[model samples]
Target: MAVPKRKTSKASKRTRRTHQKASSNAVSYDSVLGVYKRSHYISPDGYYKGRKVID
Candidate 1:
């Protein structure tokens, strides 16, 4: 009896790499300013166009 070996593909490898890279740059909820966030809110980073001042 012969055992079959698992096969790997280039596309799968590329996808895995892309997924890893994306996961490495993921944001954490700890930085979220929930109290300041509103409907149609702009980020505190202040880089958005025509962002309304929260003050």
Candidate 2:
């Protein structure tokens, strides 16, 4: 089995993981309902793309 030749340094490890950090979800405002919701998803009031999709 292949193995690493040396222990990874803290700085090197952290640098490699810089792009792996958690990111916030995309949110947008629902003008009709006057609320915020995740982008591309239906709002709590059953609206999608600025139209009602469910009762």
Candidate 3:
């Protein structure tokens, strides 16, 4: 079996894991509906890319 020869340091571990942190959601505001929604996703009122997709 393989094992680590030395103890891992906190600074080194934290530096490596910096990019592993959770990122904020990409939200955008809909001018027509006046609400915030995730980017590239259709609004709750059936509008996408600034056009009505459904009635």
Q: With candidate 1 superimposed using the best TM-score fit, by how many Å does residue 24's alpha carbon deviate from the native? A: 12
lDDT of 3: 0.90
Best by TM-score: 2
Candidate 3 residues 1-55, lDDT tens each?
9999999999999999989978899999888888888999877789997899988
- In order of lDDT, best first, we have 3, 2, 1
lDDT of 1 by residue, 1-55 (tens): 9774877688887888885654333332323453433344456765223444554
lDDT for every model? 0.50, 0.89, 0.90
TM-score of 2: 0.83
Evaluated against the true structure, the overall lDDT of model 1 is: 0.50
lDDT of 2 by residue, 1-55 (tens): 9999999999999999999979999999888888888899987778898899988
lDDT of 2: 0.89
Off by over 4 Å in 1: 1-4, 20-55
> Is candidate 1 or 3 superior in TM-score?
3
Model 1 clash pairs are none
User: What is the Cα-based lDDT of residue 35 in candidate 2?
Assistant: 82
- Give all TM-scores, in the order shown: 0.25, 0.83, 0.75
